[model samples]
Target chain A: MRGLEKLVTGRLEGVEHGSGVGMDALTQYRNSVKERLDSADVLVAKLVHENTVLSQTVETRTQEVENVRHQLKTLQNRVAELEGREARQEEEIEIVKDLFEHLCGVRVHKSYEDDTGLWFDASQGSRNGIMDYKLGFVKNESSAGTEVVYVPLLKQRSSDELRALQKQLPGYMFDTLSFPLKSLYQFYSKMARSLSKKIE
Target chain B: MRGLEKLVTGRLEGVEHGSGVGMDALTQYRNSVKERLDSADVLVAKLVHENTVLSQTVETRTQEVENVRHQLKTLQNRVAELEGREARQEEEIEIVKDLFEHLCGVRVHKSYEDDTGLWFDASQGSRNGIMDYKLGFVKNESSAGTEVVYVPLLKQRSSDELRALQKQLPGYMFDTLSFPLKSLYQFYSKMARSLSKKIE
Candidate 1:
């Protein structure tokens, strides 16, 4: 609209300036106008070409942005899913390690740098018939037939109480013992049969 | 350039067709040419305006696309990092659980659906001097002062071998007992007192 307004202004100026011109001057004015129009036409064609190319590029870029946005949404969901899985897995490791240490009285040393045997040094804690056992766990490889397990059962007691009992009772002795899981099953079954009826 | 070429073509045609023209005919031709020039000038002005606006829009759109691409790169890296963390956490859980089950001879059941206590039932395996204790772990809440832990030590042996030994040796016996972690430390230290006086 502004360009059109400028055109109107130019026409009004032409009315004021172009009055009483000779025929030769009119011929000259006509030539000048035609040359100006020629150059303007050329400029217009170039502008049209540039605009066409720019419009196409913008359209393509906009589409790419939309596609990337969609991809971003999918990736966001996947990242959340993986994060949830990781937190849960970390919690499980912490729980199992805590329970193992609480029950066995030995710190488990697991090095992620290497994946081989799982071990805890019970050489320090083995003491009595009930709390004097050493334990170790071997990995079960695919080549192995069955998952090997060694279960040891011992009771929890206070060190101070045991010391007090020992001072009162002379000539008492306790020792560490080893037995397979199956031995425990048989031993307990036999003992259960001999349980005192009064205690039951 | 092609628009300029068309102008040249029109001028050559004018030279060929406008020969021997009178003043009246020339004036009529000039006016007609002036009208065409006015319309062409208007079109040129409109095109220049459109091209300026289009160029500005394209520049802004290009900058937006660049910014979006940078954000996409950052998000992609975050997704990859989370995935790596998840994989490592998963591997640690597998390693810990496998080892715990192998050493304890019991499957560990961990439920991540809730966050509270950690538990394992050893009622089935508690028997004998070597493996007759129960083990359970409680979470260490910040509200509590100390992480309370109970430890028991038991040995491993084959049940069939024990049965055979019992049959061969009359009045042989095996039994389970309980003791505290501190008691174990004292007892083991004392036993280290009795380790073969000759073996050294």
Candidate 2:
């Protein structure tokens, strides 16, 4: 009976030892699982944070691009307005040029010296008196106002004759006049008429 | 002895059942972890795909914006070019107009009737012989060539006198001459000299 009791006690102790080892294995497994879960949670959180930053960056960049587009639209409108004004100005210039050409019956030429004036040819009722005419504005040192200079070809006429003629024509102030075209024409017409009457 | 055997056997069976239950619980936990890992993998793949597509969309939109910027630059250049041309043309027109006014001795006015011409007053040496001159281009139905019309005030002159005058002035073609100003001036000058000689 003593030998049988010893064997049974030894078997019970062995079972108890086996239960202790099983509990330790379960504890180790639970620790490993907890660690894996913690790591996964950290990864998900990092990914979510990165995604939020990227989305915000996209929104900011989109707003900046929209602002650039608006600026481009405004510039386009300004360009169109300038082009329209330029076209109208060009048309106005053409009309004025055509009118001048038709009325004067002459080809207009820019002066060789500068772009400030124009030069042309005129005749006094006959080829015997062809004149090269220059029409321009001049500023005198003593004068406050600009004067219109109308120089007709006076190769045959003396300075005395020119002075007398200027005196006879009320508007001429020594080849310069306030009124340009009208005064020049009147001076020539009066001279012609006076010369004609002298012969008559 | 029988009672002791029953106690040991029952305890052994209880331990086996507890181990079986622990194993079942561990398996259930493992399966749940595996399901979570699979769902996370699917979510990661979806996010990666969306990121790639978004990146490609950003590239395309950037290219579109760049294209618009290039177009805007080109338009701006064109506008500047047009404005420059318009300014130069305006200056040219102004010079031409000033030249005509100075040479012609008349006020240039646009005819209200048509865009074909301008009107001005002219004189034949005396106020008694003032003339309304029409200087214009004419295209006759019967003629293939365009003619320049220079109609002078012929109020007192007879048709017979005009025909004789036209014959005497080699350059006159019934007041329609290829060279308007020179021919008209020559004809008038010859008449004035002839009339002066007659009076003398």
Candidate 3:
């Protein structure tokens, strides 16, 4: 106990260096020493806990980084696949469009400006079966309950040629039933609007 | 100085808890006392740093949680909008299906079913003008030049009526042409396939 008393005296002496006049104030010196001792105990315990929590946080962050990298790789692969499919579909649509224009004389155009290639004109007419009239002539005949009939588009036909074709055809007659151009136009317009909306 | 001596003695008294014998073991106790004092100084500084770092980390995590919550809200809104559009499209498709059945005398079914409903079978002859006919039907037969024709589908015609209709008409002739059940099936199938693919 005497040795411990001597040791404490030595520690107090060491603290006296910067304290100087403050150390001479006995009450102040005593209070300062007590504060330092109590603070040191709390500091040690708090440091140990913080170290543990920091290590756990670092581990969790590393795991999160790895998960994000894996997701990025998966998303990149999907984008490549989708781009390839979009290219293929665009090609198929072009081929189908050409076939439709050639066989149907419908002049299926992506835009209104593409009208020079086909034989159809300002007035549109369509039929579903064999026809007797010459091309590019207009006539009115009651539908005979037959759903299929030939529709011939008489492009640039003179009034005389049209009258002859109409007179000769009789029961078969020239086409006056209007094609459902409005329905098709609406469908495509809606499709375009929807696509634009998606882009936005 | 007198008070300092008293303070030192008081501290040593607290350390003398295990000293039942005498000053023979006091040197070891003094060494332990020195180590504890030195460790306390360092532990104090370390605790301040740890506390500062922990506080900063907690603030950052709170902000991140708030940002994630905002993003989730945006995603939920987008999902709700898409669900609404999907419901409307479903109703429109049902109405269109009814119209097609009434107008074409063919029942529309999902593409997967076989030999049932108004499903178009491509293997059956190319009855519609839409199909690619390899040359069984007559092509541009006018003496003047090639002409574009739209053929209508003949409905429920007897053999005699069909023969008489053929004599009256002049463009391409067909033994039979199928209704456009397959086209409608293809359109819906493509749409469903595209949407499903997008979801995946």
For model 1, how does the per-residue alpha-carbon lDDT over A1-200 read when each residue is reduced to its tens digit?
33543553464345336644344544454455445555666667777888798788778878877887777788778778877877777767767665555443334544333244433333112222222223433444653533223333324447763453344322212333334433432332222222211221
Q: Where does model 2 exceed 4 Å of error?
A: A1-95, A111-136, A147-200, B1-28, B59-67, B70-74, B77-95, B105-200
Write model 1 residue lDDT over B1-200, tens digit each, in one string.
34543653465346335654344544554444454556666776677778788778778877877887787788789888987887777777666655544444334544323244333433112122122223333344653422333232224447763453344322312332234433433332222222212221
TM-score for each predicted model, relative to the true structure:
0.48, 0.48, 0.36
Interface RMSD of the candidates, in order: 8.2, 14.7, 10.7
Q: What is candidate 2's lDDT per residue for A9-103, written digit by digit as tens?
A: 34334433564536444444444434444544565556666666666666666776787678788877877787787776666555554444443
- Using lDDT, give the best candidate's number: 2
Query: Per-residue lDDT for B1-200 in model 3, tens only?
Result: 23433454465444444435234334443454455556555555666677678656655654554555555555555555555545544543443333222222223333221232211221111122121122111232444333222233455567764564444433343444332322322332232222222111
Clashing pairs in 2: A125-B185, A181-B105
Q: Which of candidates 2 and 3 is the stronger one according to lDDT?
A: 2
Put down candidate 2 lDDT per residue, B159-182, tens digits, no spaces.
775554444433442354344432
Single-chain TM-score of chain A, each candidate: 0.45, 0.48, 0.40
The ten-residue window of minimal lDDT in model 1 chain A covers A191-200
Where does model 1 exceed 4 Å of error? A1-38, A106-110, A114-200, B1-42, B109-200
Backbone collisions counted per model: 15, 2, 21
Q: Report lDDT (Cα) of residue A111, candidate 1.
A: 37
Q: What is the lDDT of residue B153 in candidate 1?
A: 27
